[model samples]
Target: MRIYAHRGASKDAPENTLKAFCLAFSQHADGIEFDVYQHENGIIVFHDRTLRRRANAEGYLLETPWSTLQTLDIGDGERIPTLNETLGVVPTNKWCNIEIKHLVDVKRWVNDVKAALSQSQIAIEHVLVSSFNHHWLKAITDLWPEVKIGALSASYELDCTASAKALNAYSVNIALDAVDKTFVQTVLSEGFNVYVYTVDEPKDMEMLAQWGVTGIFTNVPELAKRVMAKRASAKDAVSDKS
Candidate 1:
């Protein structure tokens, strides 16, 4: 199973910073997931609508200008990274899962992302767009059919399989707590990939792998690596005995 760094190794470094992303890459995560929001001038990396968690400021991320957002320290002297800057910093080999946080004039943001990616000459296969807003994902898929998209859900009440089909999503990302072997099987039976989020424990990683998940979003990429390695070693030993 692929292990993606949730918010770029958020447990060790400040979430959604260049430093965090570099740490995740160094730790050998298959992909890095980060949240994106459209600013007045450009797109910036952050999870919350308010900047209080990352910075001392008390305003909405969209309300603040890019320049002001750039100045605010997101713990440990790391500043918010723009989408272009993040793309430049991230290695070409590692996959990037950019989750759109809000849905407002996403056409421009989608166009900008596509334009920036086109200019960089990076492989399109390494990027995947995901969002909780079904309409936003639909819009992205409509405009950029080649780019892979994932339907993100925090609850099981929504029919993930139906949503995936409706949005033409390549994968469905759901909360770790809500997923199990049956859920994975159900989604896989429908011909859609299944991935779970924010998995931090080693036991949970093993369980998810056994459940046949395609990927896992984790705050601690190192922990995920260690767990995966252990599982692989154990499987090899069992095969040798057989």
Candidate 2:
């Protein structure tokens, strides 16, 4: 299974900050995932609707301009990074998952993402656009059919695989709590990838891997890499004995 750093090794650095992203790559994560919100001037990498949570400041992110937002430290002297600025940290060999944190101008954001990828000389196919808003995901697909889309969900009420097929999604990201063998099997059987979000525990990671999950979004990519390595070593030993 591929390991995607959830908001970029978030446990080590401020979530969604450049520091976290750099740390994720340094930790040898297969990919990096970050949230993006469209601002008046440009797109910014952040998670919450307001700055109160991470920035320790009081203001709605949408209401604040880029000039002011960039100055406010989210944590540990880390400032909010623009989408392009964040893209600069990603290597060409790795993938990037960009989650739309809020429902904003879909067209503008899609175009902006494309431009950023182009400017960075990154392959468009290596990027996956994900959002809780199915409409926004669909809009992204409509605009850039080649780009992969991921349907984000926190509940099992909907048949995730069916929804993924309907959206032409490359994958579906569900909360780790909602995952089970049946759900994983059903999604995989439908020919779409299944990615579990925010999985950090070793046991849960092993369980998800045993169930054939396509990828995992975790706050600690280094830990995931270690666990995967150990698992691989154990399997090799068993094979050698056999």
Candidate 3:
């Protein structure tokens, strides 16, 4: 299974900051995942709607201007990064997952993401835009049909994966709590890739790998890599003994 750093190596650096992203790549994560919100005039890479948890500041993120927001220290002296700034650090060959936390203009964000990718020279096929708001994803697909999309969900739907099917999603990005052996089998059976989020526990990682999950999002990408490597070695040893 591929390991995507959840908001970068967030366990080590400020979530969604450039430091975290660079660190994630250095740690050899398969990809990096970060949240973006269309701010006052630009898209900023940040995870929370409020600054309390990340910045230790006041007021909602939407109400704050970029000038003020940019000055606030998130952690380890890491300033909030713009979409372009974040994209600038991504390796051309690694995967990129950009989750739309909120956006008012789908077209603008799409253009921004496109321009950023072009500037970074990252392959369009290597990127996946995910969101719980399937309508926004639908809008994205309508605007850029070639753009890959990942359908995000916190609940296990009765339809199994109608949301993903509707958008022809590249992957089904789901909450860790919502996935199980049966759910994995069901989604895989339907031919959609399954990616679980915020999986930091080794046991959970092992279980998800055993269930054939395409990837996992975790705060500790280094640990996730170690666990997967160890699992692979054990499987090889068993095969040799057999």
> How do the residues 71-187 of candidate 2 rate in per-residue lDDT, one tens digit apiece?
998889999999999999898889899998875777888788888888874688778889988888887788889998998998875666877987999998999888788999988
* Per-prediction backbone clash count: 0, 0, 0
lDDT, residue 94, candidate 1:
77
Superposed model 2: Cα runs more than 4 Å off? none
lDDT tens digits by residue: candidate 1, 126-152: 888899888888988887898888989
Q: Distance (Å) between predicted and true CA of 182, model 2?
A: 0.6
By lDDT, is 2 or 3 better? 3
Q: Estimate each model's TM-score.
A: 0.96, 0.97, 0.97
The predicted structure with the larger TM-score, 1 or 3, is 3
Clashes of 1: 0
User: Each candidate's root-mean-square deviation in Å?
Assistant: 1.3, 1.1, 1.1
Candidate 2 TM-score, C-alpha based: 0.97
Q: List the residue pairs that clash in candidate 2.
A: none
Query: Alpha-carbon error at 92 in model 1, in Å?
Result: 2.3
Local distance difference test scores for all models:
0.87, 0.89, 0.92
Score residue 21 of candidate 1 by CA lDDT. 89
Q: Rate residue 73 of model 3 by lDDT.
A: 93
